[model samples]
Target: MKKTTILDLVSRKLAPFMLLFGLYLLSYGHMSPGGGFQGGVVIASGVILLFVAQGVGTTASLFPFRTLSLVEAAAFLLLLAAGLAGLAAGAGFLGNPMAGVDVRAVPRVSMILVYNVLIGLKVGAGISFVCMYLFREGR
Candidate 1:
């Protein structure tokens, strides 16, 4: 059983581009529309494109289950640690501690950007890993 077609090729070719778009959305999230969660799903869809174009095996090779799991876990822990840092700084849990920081130097927006990137990577890797794992099970 396989999925080999012009459409699959097109998807395979477009998957990286889709991933770039998703990253763009995540990077610009603080300034414009879309954010970590949305971008993360988009990135996961890009990974899905590989599965649909090739197969579970090929996709898994590109993104090993163990590596993906590690990345996902690291991203989650980083996000949690960032929030905890904010709380420890006396800004309350998940609060925007950057607000009180030296805006003229660091700028509060940087915190949001970092958070967005962390969340995006966490969610993207987690979702993609889950999908890949399930698809592998199916095979």
Candidate 2:
């Protein structure tokens, strides 16, 4: 059966907030229970809600697979580069390096925050792409 107007409306209305909350989760993951993977899944769930109600064609117009693929790759590379930076700093891969840096506001290169965001982006895009493909195939 086709989706109802209420479903469409609710999905659209709530998705932005869900996305925002997912970001919040990513940001505060170091201090709280949730983290990158959870936030990424949350963001994808919002998008998937729209996809389920609106169809892949419509969702694809807004979030094309190519764009998400690029995002996924870029996020991975960024995460990798961050890891390499830690290694170059004489720390282990993905190690925190700014704990003793003299700079006050250079972010101390908060690895937790950075990794959470990168992981969130990668996972969100990966999951979205999979769903898009499945939807396209009518699976």
Candidate 3:
């Protein structure tokens, strides 16, 4: 596939904004409609755009398969650990650990925020890894 200078330049300029939007959605998901899954998809879309515009090799160098795999796995494990922590704390599975604490002491949505961040990371890494693998196979 031949790369065009225009495509490369546009993608380079636009991808950062897409990633920033994704982060915004992830961080404010508890208060808004968008959440981890939406944010992750947005992030993956940005990577995919770069992959198509710059070619898979260049994108892969920036986001290596090994690192993506590790991130996905680590995020998954952490999410599970969070759930287990809730269970061990007698809140049941996926329950909030701060349930008994005073509302004034901590934010009620703190756990949701953690979950959103982890899920966003997991979904973004998993999707990007899959897309990269497919692009590699197509080569």
Candidate 4:
């Protein structure tokens, strides 16, 4: 969709807030309806607002595609590493090391938060990068 300058401005202004809320969604995914993928897509929508308002070049400068790609890759790798750590620690693959973790005498949800955050970031950046590239192709 062709976004007007006003839409763009609104999106830009809302980006940070969307990001914060996305984080919240990811963190609470296990206990709620949202998750890494959902929250990441939400964050991507926020970035898309920038592209719509400022132009791809300008938005890309704000968030370089190369950096976003690297970050996405690294986040995925970190997710894998975290899982591996659980395995190495005597938990099987994809096992929850935090299964035994107690926070204030309550069992912690373990690595769910980390996974959510990483996946959210990866998904958000990856989608935003694609949209930015597509948006640039026309202009």
Candidate 5:
């Protein structure tokens, strides 16, 4: 595929906003409709856009495969740790650890927020890695 100067420039300009939007979705997900999966897909779409506009080699250099794999692994482990912490706290697996806490002291949605962030990181890294691999294989 031939890369165009205009496509590359536009993608570079737009990618940051896509990332910011994804973060917004993850942060406010507890109060709104968007959540981990959706936000993560959005983030991955930005990277994929770069892959298409800038070529696989350039994009891969910016987002290395090793780094993406490690990030995905770490996010998954943290999610599991969160679930275990909840179980240890007697809230059941994947339940809110702060369920009994006063809402004023700490919002009841804190756990949901944490879960959203972790899941977003995991999904984003995993999808980006897979797409990067596919793009390379096509070469």
Candidate 6:
């Protein structure tokens, strides 16, 4: 009946640190080795830990399937929109379109960071949802 065991306690304590690390990876992906997909999986693993430690029902309550879907959709749209922005700027897709412009806000570094964050959030939610559903189906 009790889900709050020592393992759960440890997971709870450790999850935040894992999440922070994942965010760090996403933010610093361009500068470092890791990137969006990697950080996303890390974050998803943290969520999966919570799901296992707290049980599917509890995890679902905190991060519902519908919410995950929304996050994924939003992230995807934003990522696409980002590419579309480059196209609109007449630099094709993902190319430096704003080079002739101010080059302050739409710089390459900032775009990469934004892309990484979006991709990280999207993949994290997608993988976590997959894990939860699989566990629910007894697979």
Q: For this target, which candidate reaches the highest lDDT against the unseen true structure?
A: 3
Q: Number of clashing residue pairs in every model?
A: 0, 0, 0, 0, 0, 0
Predicted candidate 6 versus true structure: per-residue lDDT over 1-139, tens digit per residue: 4665698789989988988899889999999988999999999998898887878888788889899989988999999998888899988897665665786546657878878999999999899889988877345
- For model 2 the local lDDT of residue 66 reads 92
The candidate 6 region of ten consecutive residues with least summed lDDT is 99-108
Q: What is the lDDT of residue 85 in candidate 3?
A: 82
Question: What is the TM-score of each predicted model, taking all chains together?
Answer: 0.90, 0.91, 0.93, 0.83, 0.92, 0.88
- The TM-score-based order of candidates, best leading, equals 3, 5, 2, 1, 6, 4
lDDT of 5 by residue, 1-139 (tens): 8777888789999998998999999888889989998999999998898888887789888998899999999999999999999999899999887886667877888899999999999999999999988888445
Q: Give per-residue CA lDDT, model 3, range 7-77, as digits (tens).
A: 88999999999999999999999999889999998999999998888878888889988999999999999
The best candidate in terms of TM-score: 3
Candidate rank order under lDDT: 3, 5, 1, 2, 6, 4
Poorest stretch of ten by lDDT in candidate 4? 101-110
Q: Pull out the clashing pairs in model 3.
A: none
Candidate 1 global lDDT: 0.87
Off by over 4 Å in 4: 1-5, 100-107
lDDT of each: 0.87, 0.86, 0.91, 0.82, 0.90, 0.86
The digit string of per-residue lDDT tens for model 4 on 1-139 reads: 5757677677778878987888778888989999999999988887887777777777787899899999889988998998897887677887887665555754457478878888998899899878877888555
The residue-by-residue lDDT of candidate 1 on 1-139, one tens digit each, is 5565886779878999989988998999999998999999999999988876677787888888899899999998999999998898789888777777666878788889889999999989999988887777454
Q: What lDDT would candidate 5 get against the real structure?
A: 0.90
lDDT score for residue 20 of model 3: 94
